[model samples]
Target chain A: MPLLKDNDFIDDTWQRLDDGAAIPATGDILVSLARLLADFGKLSNRDGRLGVEFPNEERPGVLESFLPDLSLIALTFPKFADGRAYSQARQLRQLGYDGELRAIGDVLPDQLSFMLETGFDAFEVTERFPEEAWEQAASSISLTYQSAAYQPRRLHVWRLRWARDEGV
Target chain B: MYRYDEFDHRFVSERVAQFRDQAARRLSGELTEDEFKPLRLMNGLYLQLHAYMLRVAIPYGTLSGKQMRKLADVADKYDRGYGHFTTRQNIQYNWIKLEETADLLQELSEVEMHAIQTSGNCIRNVTTDHWAGAAADELADPRPVAELLRQWSTLHPEFSFLPRKFKIAVTGAPNDRAAVKVHDIGLRMHQNDAGERGWEVIVGGGLGRTPLIGYTVREFLPETQLLSYLEAIMRVYNLHGRRDNKYKARIKILVHELGEENFRAEVEAEFARQKELDVEVESRELERISNYFAEPAFETLPRLSTGYEAARAGDPAFAQWVRSNIAAHRKDGYAIVNISLKPEGGIPGDATSEQMRTVADLAERFSVEEIRVSHHQNLVLPHVKLDDLHEVWKVLAANGLASANIGKAGDIIACPGLDYCTLATARSIPIAQTISRRFADLNRQHEIGPLRINISGCINACGHHHVAHIGILGLEKKGVEYYQITLGGSSATDASIGTILGPGFSGDKVPDAIETIVNTYLNLRQGGDDSFLDVVRRLGHQPFKEALYAPA
Candidate 1:
C-alpha cells in the first residue's frame, strides 16, 4: 500500500503487527487496539515507537492515557460512507494527540480533502488512483467556511471578509 | 435579499469547479454509481422516475429579480420549460440531463446561487419564514442567521456524511409559518422578560415514516452562541445517530431512543466543549449579515388606500383575492401579496418559464426587486404597496398566477409522486388536481374556510402529509393504488402528527372522501368562525373517520 502524506506518496516506516506475532526488535510498529490493550506493559517497554490501529467504533477518549507513549494513531474507514473516523480524528487531535494521524482502509481520492481537513496526516492507499488524483482532490476547493482540524489558525470566511473590508 | 459578497462568490465558483471534476470523473467510469450518487445529491441532483432533477436552493426562500429570471432561463434552456417549487422552499426542474448539470450549475452560479447541500446527509438548505421581514407580527428577521447557517454547513467536512439527511428551520414570529416544528432542528426567536431576544432551540422534530414532533432543548439560547450550540447538536447526532437502518437514522430517532433529557445533556456537554474551542463567529459578523436583511425603505402613506378599497368594492373577484391572498404587512402602506401556484385542476407548484419571467418582471416593478417562495408552494410579493395591489392582481390574473385560494381548500400541497419521483408508490398530483377541481367554486372554498390538504405518494412524507390538517398518504397494495387519510395535524406552534383515520380508499374515491370529511366538518361546526383544523382538533378524528368508513 502507498502512503500519502503532504500531497505526495511517502515511504511507510511503520510495521503493522498481527495478533500473536513475534515482536520486532527495533523498528517502529503498528498494532491493533486489542493487541495494545492486551500487551500494554510489554508494548510500552519496547524500544520501537508505538502506534495503534484504532477502530472507528471506539471513542477516541479511550486512548488518552496512551497518547504520551504513542507516535502514530491509524483510524480505519471500513467504508468511505461511514464517517465515524472523521469525528474520532478530530477528538484525538483535540485530546492533544500530536502524533501522525493515519487513515487506513477504504480511502479514496475524493475523500482526501475531507480527511485532510479532519486532521489525517497520512493515508494508506491502494493503487486504484494516481498521486495526481489525490493532489487534485485535496486542493480542489480553495476556500472553506468552517474551522477544521488541519486549519485551526485559518479564519472563517466571515472574519476574512471583515478583515478585508477593514483593510487589515 | 442578501447579495453574495466576493468571498461567497469565490466559494461557490470553487465548489462548482470541484463538482465539475467529480462529474467528469464519474462520466469517465472512474467512479461507480454508488460513489457518485452521494456526490451528485450533495449538489442537489437526483435521478428521478424518468429524468434527472435538479433542485436549486433559494436560500431562506429569498430571491432577487435577477435570480428569478436566471431560474426561468435555466428552465427554458436545460429543462422542460417549467420548474416545481418544493415544500422546502426550493425549486426543482424534473427534466434535467446529467451531462448538462455542470453547465446548469455554472449558469446558476452567475446569479449567486448553487444547489449546494440542497440534498445529502449533511445539513440541508436552512429555511425561515417566507414573510420574514414583511410579516406584521414578526419579532425580527430570521434570514441573517439562516444565511449564516447556510455558509457554515456548506461542505462541512465532518458532517457531510452523517447518518442521514438533516433539516433546520427558523422562524422570527410566534406563529410558525416556516413549519419549524416538523424540521430536524427548529429555531424559534424568543424574547426574555428583559426584552432580550434569543432562540428557543427545538431538536429532533421530523416528519417521515416515523412522524415525531421535536422537543424543546433550550428555552432561551443567547443569539451569539447559536453556531456553537448547533455544532454541539450536530456532533452529538453524528456520533450517536443510528446507521444500521436508513429509516431510523434521523436525529429524531436518536432523541427518541436515548430520551430527550439524555439528548439534551449530551448536547449541553458537547456545547460546553465546543465553546472551549472558541469556534463561534464573532458578534460583529452576525451584525454584518443582519445589515443585509435590514428593512427596505418605505414611503410613508396613509393606513388605508382609497384606491384599493374602491377597486375591491367594484370588482368582486379582486375583493375575494384581497380577502384570501393578501396579508397584513409590517409597514403601513404595504401588503404581502401571496401568488397561488395552485390553480383550478392545475399541477400544484409547477410554473412555466413564461410565468417565472412575468413574476420576475412584476417583482422588479412592484415588490422592491424581491420575491419569496413559500413552503406552501406559493410565491409571495413580500412588499407590494396597497395601491399597487390592483395592478399586481391584473398582471397575475393575466399570467394565471392569481388564485383566490391561498389558505382555502383548493390550495392543496402535493408531491411529484409517481409522475416524477421513483420512490412514490402512487401518483399525488392527479389526486390533488381532482380535489382542487372538486372545490373549484370560489364561494364553496371560502365557505369551507382555511384548510390544508397535504398529499404524499409514500411514507417518506416529502409533501408534509403528517403536518396537514387533512393528510392523505398514497400506498400501493398488490399493484393497486390506495390512499389513507389522517386529520388534525399541524406544522404550527401547536404542532402534532395526525392520527390515521381508517381504511384506505381507491384513487378515484380520495377526492370524494376528502369532500365527505369536509362536509362532515361543516355540519358539525358551531359557527362560521370555526376553522376545519379547529373543528377536527376539538371533535377528534372519530366523526371524520365514521363518515369516511361508514358504508353508506
Candidate 2:
C-alpha cells in the first residue's frame, strides 16, 4: 500500500523549505509545468520529492495518469472567473491519488472554502490575505457533506443540522 | 388549480435529494466549483453582483393562494422581505447565499414548486396565457399543454445541452396576450375546417439586437403530435443552431440565417425522423397529462347583474375602472379584473408583502382562488362577478393594488433595469415612473389610445422594449444616461419590431421625445379609433421621424 500522510506530515516539509535557503535532497519539490519543462534535466535528486502541476485547461485523463506515486499535484487557477480547476481538482481526488493536492497561484480568499471542498489539501495561500482571513474562510461553514477526495469516509451536514435543531 | 400528484411530489422530492447530494459534494471537495457551476445553474441559482440569486419559476404566472403564501414564506425566511416578479413570469430573490439555497429548494418543494431548468442551456418555464382557463375568448386552456411541455422538457437529457437557452409560449386567446409571436416556439390553439382543435405553431420569434417575429411554420398542427413536433424543432435547433458566438446562438438566428422555408423543411424532416418514436407522443400519456388541467368547478350564473348598472351610475371611479381595468368575459356578468401593479408614481410590477397576502385572500374569497400575473406587469382576477367588482376593487384599493391602468400607458412594462439587474446599463424604473407621472392624466392616456412604452436598460431586451409601441432603450453615453426611442412595435398576432427614429436623446429630453411620438401619431391617425401602432404601421416612421427632428 502507498504511504498515507496527513496535514502534520505536510507542515514539517513546508517548515524545512522555510528554514533552508535551498531545498535539501530529501525535500519534495512541487514544480509547475512551465518550471518543470524549463529545468528539464538541470536539477536531479533520485529520491527527492517530485510533483507535477496541472493547468485548468489540462485534460483530466492526462492528469490521472501522472497522479499516483506523485509527491504532490499543484493546480494553477488562472483567474477567479475561470473555474476549470475546480473540476480538475475533483477529478484528481476521484482517481484516488491521495498524496497532496496543493492550490498554488491566483487562488482568492473568497474561493478558499470552495477550493478545499474540491479536494485541494495544502494551500500556498497568497501573501495579500491575512492569516485570520484564511482561518475564517475555511471555517466559514462549520458543516459540509460528500466524501472528499482526500477524506477516508463521508460526512454529511444534514444530520448535524437536524441534530442541532432537535437539541441533541 | 393542478394539485401535485404522486409523480410530481416524488419528482420534486427526488430533485431536492439530488441537490442536497450535489451541495454535499461541493462542500466535501468531491465536486469542484467548475463541476458545480452547471449543477447550480440547472437548479436556478445564479451568482450576481452582490450575492447569489435564486429565480423561482412561477409557471405561466398562475399561482394558487396557498402557493403565493408559500412564496411569501420563502421571502420572509430566506431573503429580503419581498420577491421581484420578472417579465418572463418568474420571481427572483435578490439576496441568497449559497449555503441557504438547498434548504430554500427543499422548502419550495413542499409547495410543489422548484426552480429546475429556470436557467442554463435548457427549455425554461413554458409560459402560457396567464388567463388560460379563465379568459373569455380562449378556445382551450393552454396551461395543461404548457404543463405537459414543462414536465417533458424539465430534464430531457437530449436538449439540456443546447447552444443557448430556449423559450416556449402558448396562447389560446385571439389577442395573443402571452406574446407567443416573440418566442423560440409559439403554440396557439386553433380550430380547423373540421372544427377539430389543433395548434397554429410559430417558430423563430425573439428579441435581442436582431428581433424577428416568429413565422408560422405549421399553420395547423394536431394536438396529439404537439410533443413530437416540439421535440423535432428542438432537435433541429440542437443540431444546427450556431454555437460559434454567444450573441448569435439563439434558434432565432438559425431561423434567420437558414430562412423560413429551409428551416421549415428542416423541422419537417426532423419531425418525420421522430414520428416513429411513440414514447413521447403516445395518446395515453397525452390524455393523462391533459386530464390534470380539467376545467375548474364553475357554476353557471345569471347573465346580467341587476345591481351593476346602479353601481356604475352611482360611482364614477367604478365606471372609469370598469372601462379601463375590466376585460370582456365570455360568461356574462363575470368580468376579468386586471389589478395594476403600477400605481401612480410607484415602481412598476412591485407588490408589497401585505399586498400579496391581500391578493391571495381576494383570490380565495372573490375570484375562485385563481390569480394571474400579466406580462404587462399587472395581476388579473380572471373570474370576478360584475356584482363583486366593487367589493373586489375595495379590497384591492385597501391594499394599494387597485390601480385602474390595465392596458393603459401607466401600465408600462419596464424591466428591473440598473436598479436591480447587474446586466442593466441605465436605470429603467425612473424613466417608467417619469412617463407614467407625465401621462398620469387619465383622460390623456385614454386619448393616446393603447400605447405600450417598454423601457430596457440595455440591448438584452429583457424589458421587451423592441416590441413596444414606443420603445425606450437606455444607454450609457460617456457615463451619462441617454435614451433611444423606437416607434411602432407590437408583440401581438401582428408582430413588428420597433424602428429607431433618429439619434438618442439625453435623459431630460426623453419625455419630450415621447410627447413628439404621441402627438405625431395623434396628428397622422385616421381617427380616434386608430391606435399609435396602427397609425405607425400605416404611415411608417417618416411622419414620426419628421415630427421629432423637424428643425429641433
The top-ranked prediction according to DockQ is 1
Report the alpha-carbon TM-score of model 2 versus the true structure. Answer: 0.76
- Residue pairs whose backbone atoms clash in candidate 1: none
Q: Tens-digit lDDT track for model 2 on A1-168?
A: 111122221232532122224544565666555554455353244457667776655555565555544667877765453345655665566567788777766665445666766677777654554565466545443333222224422223223333454699
* lDDT of each candidate versus the true structure: 0.90, 0.75
- Per-residue CA lDDT of model 1 for B437-525, tens digit only, reads 99999989988889999999999999899999999999999999999998989998899999899899999999899999999999999
Q: Please tell me which predicted candidate would have the highest lDDT against the true structure.
A: 1
lDDT of 2 by residue, B284-332 (tens): 5456656767765666878778788788889887787788888877677
Best by TM-score: 1
Q: List the residue pairs that clash in candidate 2.
A: A28-A49, A117-B29, A118-B29, B205-B214
lDDT, candidate 1, at B381 = 91
